[model samples]
Target: MTAETQAAPVVSYGRLVPVVVHFDDLDALGLLHNARYPVMVERAWTALWHERGFGFDGDWEAAGDFCNAVKELRIGYEAPVNRPGAYAVHLWLERLGNTGLTYGFRFCSADGAMTYAHGTRVLVRLDAATLRPTPWSEPFRAVGRELLRRAS
Candidate 1:
């Protein structure tokens, strides 16, 4: 893909999900709690899939009663949000593997001034009932590949 078609951090990542920080999300230090980062990441990913019409908010049956389980996660902290207000989480497909997908993301200021945190997560598709790792469906793989291509 040409630079023009490459995913822009502000627009073409898998999804740009807004996060309205709540008072409850803050710790006594006046920053978002360390644990909250993962939660936000998870929420953003879920929203991405939902927006693509393949998750809980969409045709669940078409998803084949499968769920994604995190196989690995790594995060790096940058600055902290001292004020509670609007922020955003950027999600994009980093890598696609048989039975798994790796997503890269960042928590940034609403205007892209600062990146508060960044991370990558490896998710394995699993049969909800069996809880056994399963290969992703063609549609899912295609979606991941497309995101990767756009992000390239």
Candidate 2:
């Protein structure tokens, strides 16, 4: 789901993948360990970028600058699924400012019966070589805003 392929309504933020919490993903307390939430969010993030055509392949990086998200995330855990099932993560974005973009997510039961988690992430564009902050161009900005708007 790269920029080369226009985003469809179903893929406003790139993807909606189901995550099954394996037995190995739990802690002694039987709940999903807190550390796992970040990894979960990261899975969504990577897919979103790739679906919208902003992946971090060597060629893409070599050709142009990209966003390095400095995520300020907040995850709220709901029901405990020691043996978590197929949880669907609905991805969306909040807004895009000159320097940053905010992405939102709702990880819920695939059947929509219950919610597992909810959160948001902050990202910023960077120069390829220097890896410093840079303004995203109009086209990229448009794409981001469009996705964020639809999701919101």
Q: If scored against the real structure, what TM-score would every candidate get?
A: 0.81, 0.73
lDDT for 39 in candidate 2 is 84
Residue lDDT tens for model 1, 33-57? 9899889877766767766666663
List model 2 lDDT by residue over 1-152, tens digit each: 33223332244453455555667778998877778876876776666656577656655455342546585777788766666545556676688888678877776665445677777878877776677777887777767766664524
What candidate 1 gets wrong by more than 4 Å, as runs, is: 1-14, 57-66, 149-152
Q: After superposition, how far is residue 2 of candidate 1 from its true place, in Å?
A: 33
The lowest-lDDT stretch of 10 consecutive residues in candidate 1 is: 1-10
Candidate 1 clash figure, as a count? 0
Q: Which ten residues in a row have the lowest lDDT in candidate 2?
A: 1-10
Candidate with best TM-score: 1
